[model samples]
Target: MKIVIQRCSRASVTVEGQVTGEIGTGLMVLVGVTQEDTEKDAKFLADKVAGLRIFEDEDGKMNRSVLEIGGKVLSISQFTLYGDARKGRRPSFIAAARPEQAIGLYEAFNEAVKAHGLEVQTGVFGADMQVELVNSGPVTILLDSRE
Candidate 1:
């Protein structure tokens, strides 16, 4: 499993012109899973993202975790994060996990995060969706569970 986390002042996801998930003052996370990913991978990343200290503290340093600031999470399923285009102009998504396998792990990740007392909103898995976000500080970080 892998994730791209963006510190956002606000974020939302729309599917078929309907808003599905929304949040304010939080992390906009794009989640991906591969065929080799497991439940443990999902749990690991959930813990990491919830605890990562990217928000600034009063002392003017990056010292506060999302949990500390009571931030929400806009978690979006994005298989394209694993797209491979090294061989040609078109990208291949062979490395991405099938929807059946991915949805469970993705839900597990969200559940784990919610268990930490953070609100977790999510986009429709495997749906064509539109995402909007105001990236606070333009801060973005990438994480891979295997690492």
Candidate 2:
């Protein structure tokens, strides 16, 4: 599993010209599932993201987690994260799991996040989405479960 987490003042997803999911003052998560991903991977990432201390503290230090700031999460499925373009002009998606298998894990990941007691929003899986966000502090983090 891999994710690109961005601190955002607000975020929303649009599919087929219709707004699907949106949030304010939260994190925007571009989630990716690999062929080897499992429920365990989802659980680990959800827990880690919930506890990640990227939000600022009273003293203006990055010491508070998103949960502490009453923030929300906008999770988007992005199978292209696994695109391997190392040796060719075209990107190869062999590392990404097939849609059937990926959907279950993707839903499981979001459910895991919700299970952590946080508000979790999401985009339609396998849809062409237009995501908009006001990146707060422009703070971004990359997470990988393989490690």
Candidate 3:
């Protein structure tokens, strides 16, 4: 499992010109599942994302978690995170989980985040989506279960 977490002032996802998921003052999470990913990986990453102290406190220090700030989450399924472009010009997605398996884990991840008592919005799995966000502080973090 891999995730790219971007702190955003606001975020939304659109599919076929229809808005799907949207959030304000939260994290935009792009999740990727590999063949080896399991529910445990989903839970671990979700917990980390929820408790991450990237949000600034009153002193302007990055000491508050999203939960503390009453923030939301916009989770999106992104298999390209596993794209292996080390070889030729084309990228290979062999490391990414199949859609059937990925969708389950993706949903599980979102549920895990919601379990933290924070609002969680999501983009449709396997759908062509257009995501828009105002990245707050340009703060971004990358997480990998294997690491």
In candidate 2, what are the lDDT values of residues 1-147, reduced to their tens digit? 999999999999999999889999989999999999999999999998899999999899999888999999999999999999999799999999999999999999899999878999999999999999999998999999997
lDDT (tens digit, per residue) of candidate 3 on 22-87: 999999999999999999999999999999999999999999999999999999999999999999
Q: Estimate each model's TM-score.
A: 0.98, 0.98, 0.99
Total clashes in model 2, counting residue pairs 3 or more apart in sequence or in different chains: 0
Candidate 3 lowest-lDDT run of ten: 118-127
Question: Which number leads on TM-score?
Answer: 3
lDDT of 3 at 133: 93
Which residue runs of candidate 2 sit more than 4 Å off their true CA positions?
none
Residue 37's C-alpha lDDT in candidate 3? 97
Q: Residue 94 in model 1: shift from native, Å?
A: 0.6
Model 3 steric clash total: 0
TM-score of 3: 0.99
The lDDT, on a scale of 0 to 1, for candidate 2 is: 0.94
- Report the Cα lDDT for residue 79, model 2: 96
Residue pair clashes in candidate 2: none
